[model samples]
Structure formats: C-alpha cells, structure tokens
Target: MNLYVRSANGYRVASVDEVVSAAKRAINRKYRRGQAFTSPKVVEDYLRVKLSYEDNEKFVALWLDGRHRLIAYEELFQGTIDGTSVYPRVVVQKAIAHNAAAVIVAHPHPSGVAEPSAADENITRRLKQALELVDIRLLDHIVVGKQCVSLAARGLL
Candidate 1:
C-alpha cells in the first residue's frame, strides 16, 4: 500500500515500502553522529530502519560512551524467525572491548509483535546483571516490530 508523506517541501505520494526504506536511509545518514541518543525513540527509529525489514530475528547492541554517545552498533546475534540465543558473556565482552559505559540492546520480532516474550525478560535480567559487573549500564532492551516496546519504560530493565 502507498501513503502520502509530508516532506519539508510538501506532501508526496509513495508506496509504504518505499517510504519506509527512504526514511531508514535518511535517518541513518542524518543521525550518524551529532545526535547523542537521548531517548528510546532514537534507538527505535534506528532499529526500524536497519532491522525492521528483515525476515529473521536479529539481536543488536548499541554501545554508548559515558555521555551516551554512540560507540558502535553491532548485530551480535542472528537466528530464525522464532528466536535468537543471546549470550550475556558475549555482550559484556563486547562492551568491555568497546569501552562502552552504557548499552541499548534491541531485537526485532519478525511476527510484527513488539511484546517481550518470557525468554526476552530472562535474558534482559541476565544481561543487566552481567553488564553491571563490568560497570556498564543497561539502558534499555527494546523489542522492535510493528511497534517498539522499551523494556526500560516498562521497568523491565
């Protein structure tokens, strides 16, 4: 389906798929640096652009410095449509390796439901505790699908 998108110039008609693709690319290019990711929306927009179109599940980590600036973003794990195995050890290792003071971890649900599964909660707990040991804070665990659910907002973090 197509929709009308309001651009700075005016409204333009385009397919929903094309609009999403364009938005993703634009967001990536525009917010690569300068913007310190200050809200969950930033992470959500980024993951939506980068991973929302995927067929399989992907777990990505956005490593941040002490000021919450982006250190790096990495797809740490991948799996089939159902679920992916996320190891806290690996996540912590990467945080230490990158000297990340905080992290925002996110994954997409191919099923288009952003609700956290029981497994999602369990892993979030494990990752939080693991990162604590390394002095890196777990800012949030966002589940991205048709919508983005911030576990931190729900006090899941």
Candidate 2:
C-alpha cells in the first residue's frame, strides 16, 4: 500500500500516488526518447505509473516510431468518473503530428475495474479503422484499474 522513499532529508513514507509519480519519473529518465519498446511489460508498467486511480477518467496515448521506439506520450482526454469521450479524429491528428507509426492507447477506471466494456471495444475498433487509413498501427488498447487488461491480448483488436 505505502512505501518509503529516500528524500533530501531522510527516508519518508510516501503515499501510493507519490510512489507512482516517482516511478513514472524514473521510467521517463531510464527510457529516454528514441528507445524502442520491445516488451509489453514496459507498457503496462508505464501505464500503471502514469495513470493511478483518481476521481475522473483520463485517456492517454503512447506514440511510437516505425521501429516501436518512443516518440511522445500524452493524455488526450479527461472526463467524469464513469466515462470519457475519445475522438478518433483527434487521435489521428496527433499521431500524424508526431509522425508515429504505432500507438498504444489506455485509460484508467476510477472504480478500479480493469474489464474492457463494450464501448471500449467499439472505440478500439473505430480507432483501428481510423488509424489504418493513415497506415498507423494501433498496438493495443489497455484498461488500467486494479490491474491492466489488454484488448490486443484478448484478440479484440
């Protein structure tokens, strides 16, 4: 639940949120720009670190080059606790701007549920179809909650 982290003064107890933030910073430092993402675990860990539980929904995307190297990471949408709007046009535009050849999209559930709902599947379908027109690959759509569920792994994408 809670852990201790070293600080300038001494070791101090850090909340889950603080630990997640620190992990995210460390990951960002460790995996600099242009590093290829070769493993799905890295994506899962990065998502867990970046999008912890909150009262609202936040949709994020990881932009990757043709070789699966990192280009940029962004939180594109925010909404209430239950649902959020995902615009495929926005995702397409941003991918074009980054010149990304692939993308991994994810969002956290405030209720701490990792199951991909029907809407999630529909959006994934639309996103895949939209991105295909531009020759951009949709790597996966992950649902982050108590645990991560990958739609790609489930053959839903």
Candidate maximizing lDDT:
2
Top TM-score prediction, candidate number: 2
Tell me each candidate's TM-score.
0.85, 0.90
Q: Give me the runs in candidate 2 sitting further than 4 Å from their true place.
A: 5-11
Question: In angstroms, how far off is 59's CA in candidate 1?
Answer: 0.2
Task: State the C-alpha lDDT per candidate.
Answer: 0.88, 0.90
Please report how far candidate 2 places residue 94 from its true position, in Å: 0.4
* Tens digit of per-residue lDDT, candidate 2, span 16-114: 778777777898997778988888888888887777656798899999998999998899999899899999999999999999999999999889988
Q: Alpha carbon lDDT of residue 35, candidate 1?
A: 54
Residue 147, model 1: Cα distance from true site in angstroms: 0.7
How would you encode candidate 1's per-residue C-alpha lDDT over 49-122 as one tens digit per residue? 87777789989998888888887888999999989999999999999998899999999999999999999999
